[model samples]
Target: MNQSATRLNTEELNLALNLLRAGELVGIPTETVYGLAADASQPEAVAKIFAAKGRPADHPVIVHIAGVEQLAAWAQNIPDEAYLLAQHFWPGPLTLILERQAHVSDAVTGGQNTVGLRAPAHPITQQLLQHFGGGLAAPSANQFGHVSPTTAAHVRGEFSEEVLQLVLDGGACDVGVESTIVSLVGDKPKLLRPGGVSREAIEAVLGDSLEHHTNQYTAKQRVSGLLDSHYAPRTTLITGQAARLQECIAEKLAQNQKVVLICQEINTKLDIEQFLMPSSPQAYAQQIYATLRQLDLQRFDTLFLALPPNTTEWLAIHDRLARAAHHRY
Candidate 1:
């Protein structure tokens, strides 16, 4: 990693702000993931994000704001539920979908009537937003449909300095996945994506269970990270239960194929390559992407992860892993 690309000094922050103000992209850190950020008010600047990432134009990017007070600047017809959730989860990882204000650009909303907004908790990003005093249309700072970057170095590795000149180093992301997306557009709030914020926690705040609408064909909206095969690595990835994965390892080794395993327990008898992931959900989320990036660099023929339990606590992890894997049992 280049030493210049990972600094969080006043000079770097001011440079980032200047770059963004000038309609250029800057990699900004959030608790969830590093974002390729552009000033939301600048449609041309926002379009640069899509061009750089090769992201589909229709796939909307979340507009990150400084705080709840700025909500009306991007969205309108706000519901009480939006405030309730934002009050609890703002400065954290929760994105609320609401009717877009007429002035909110289609570039940011993906030509939809609604826009996604969040107030990220990373202090450095918060400071930047405060100084800039505007929304930043930022998606994960990696290639489209690839594993999201979780650190400043990861962002640097994704795009060249010429493409993304400044990356504010806020260290490793605490919540390693994207923000939880809840849509308040229709009659009922829907859980578009489960992520850094758990669905249960969101439901508790609204006192109503959110409708699970992720990856549904009939769905009317397109949001980030919902594509069937996203967050994938260049190397093939397979995911299954412990026994099935162990069987896969055996089958692969039998054919003289090189493989690696990411699991909670290391079966030393197998004798290939293995990484022991954290047993807890939060810890696992924080490390999964960085782990995948690390292993993907080694050129393994295949990578296998022992799927965590299919339970509410692990829903976010399961969602990401499911999308990342080429094959799932």
Candidate 2:
């Protein structure tokens, strides 16, 4: 973290809230990524988020509220499952999709009748929302389609000296990945995205009868972070089995291509560049984006990645990497 980066206090919080109230952007921390937040009700303020991140206007942003009590204000006809999930995972990283209230701006929902909403569990973020007294539409604080930022320095690196008036530094995010987005507006509990909150966890709270949604790449409910070619590094990425990955890396090296390999275990004695993440899923999820962000800066010819095990625990990480490597198709 930069020593000189403005730290959050009561006074700084007030200043950031003022900016948000005035329809300006403020980088607020969440359990997932630091988000570029703007008042969700203000179409102009929400537009600033898309402009700041260079995000496509078609992609929707998640409306983050202070707590579950405020859900009805932004989302209309809240389902029973929404309340159940909120009771279990509010003040945490789990976004619920429900029909939007008439007042909820179409800009925030990308013109969809349903809106994605969540109450992030970061204290500074909650305080900022409570002080601002409104829902904030926030997307990851980075250039669109790039790796998300997990720390304040990451946010600063993206917006160096660009007059980003306020950033609430809440240290590194705990879940590291984005929220598990479940849509309850349909007939059953439909999952829009796999995130830090695993399906098993949700199933444990709900039951096996809960329906899991697949990534169909549809135009109707185009959510943020679910695009085919997103969360990518500047360099090309290849993901697969370890032995085959080693062979592919060697082939790349034979072609005089500089490469970096990211894996859970550094067992292979490959002379090329390599990095290892913790074997634990939680720790790996926390560091995955940051590692990719760092390696993306090296300007390597390609990124040779080891495929994570085909298990439910690694679903979110795999989903992200798969999207990052979509161009290989």
Index of the highest-lDDT prediction: 1
Task: Please report, in order, the local distance difference test score of every candidate based on alpha carbons.
Answer: 0.90, 0.82
Q: Residue 74 of model 1: what lDDT?
A: 87
Per-residue lDDT for 247-299 in model 2, tens only?
77778899999888888788557988789878888888899888988888898
lDDT of 2 at 175: 79
Model 1 spans > 4 angstroms off: 1-8
Clash count list over all predictions: 0, 0
Model 2 TM-score?
A: 0.93
TM-score of 1: 0.96
* Each model's Cα RMSD: 2.5, 2.6
lDDT of 2 at 178: 84
